[model samples]
Target: MKPQHLLAAATLVLATTAFAAGDPHDHAHAHTPLHGGVVVEVKDIDYELVAQPSVIQLHLRDHGKPADVSNATARLTLLTGTEKQEVVLKPAGDKLEATGSFKVAPGSKAVAVVTVAGKPSTVRFVLK
Candidate 1:
């Protein structure tokens, strides 16, 4: 084969390999919760939050396994129409939970600020 043709083929092969290596095809945001809650991802960590009429719970997982949040603190903000309320969540076993009467409707939206090891991350959810 000609040297120029060989060089072109090698360049194509290298480019393809590099592109495949950098491709984010893992679908990181497509997480199905084990507890049937709303799931969101932050920094590759999955947070599943369940909202009820008078209670809220947050479950943290790392790669589908339960994660410990004993050293973490969380605050939840709920918005419905023009009213907004916030609640503080304390670590409870394998999850973070809070008890308070809340107004959660079909169009309500929630934002959770989770602080683990002193670093804070936010997750948002809009109810269907």
Candidate 2:
């Protein structure tokens, strides 16, 4: 085989191996939200954040089963441009609920800190 042909084949093998090793879009998966909100997975738990004008709700599901939030406590930070607000959430049945006058704009972001059974977890969401 020619030297140039051998080099080209070696380069092709390396490029193929590198592409197969890592995929940048591996995290992009189809997730259907049970509640009408943004869902993020944290520590094998799926947390759905529903933010309205004056109410914020966090719903949790474990492997498609509703997880209890009865003894869980949560704090939500809302960021809209230069404005920032925080809300504390308490257990309300199967989910955590917080009510306040929050400015959740289109480009806003939300970070949730939840402690369930004394274990802390964090979830993040970008408002649409």
Local distance difference test values of all predictions, in order:
0.87, 0.87
In the range 15-120, model 1's lDDT, one tens digit per residue, is: 9999889935466545887776888878778899888888789999876778879999998899999999989999999999998798888779999999998999
| Tens digits of per-residue lDDT for model 2, 15-121 | 99998889443444445687888888887788998889998999998867889889999988899999999899998888999887889877799998899999999
Cα lDDT of candidate 2 equals 0.87
lDDT of 1 at 40: 83
What RMSD does each model have against the real structure? 6.4, 4.7
Question: What lDDT is reached at residue 38 by model 1?
Answer: 83
TM-score, model 2 to reference = 0.78
TM-score each candidate.
0.76, 0.78
Clashes of 1: 0
* Clashing pairs counted in every model: 0, 0
Query: What RMSD does model 1 have?
Result: 6.4
Residue 25 C-alpha lDDT in model 1: 45
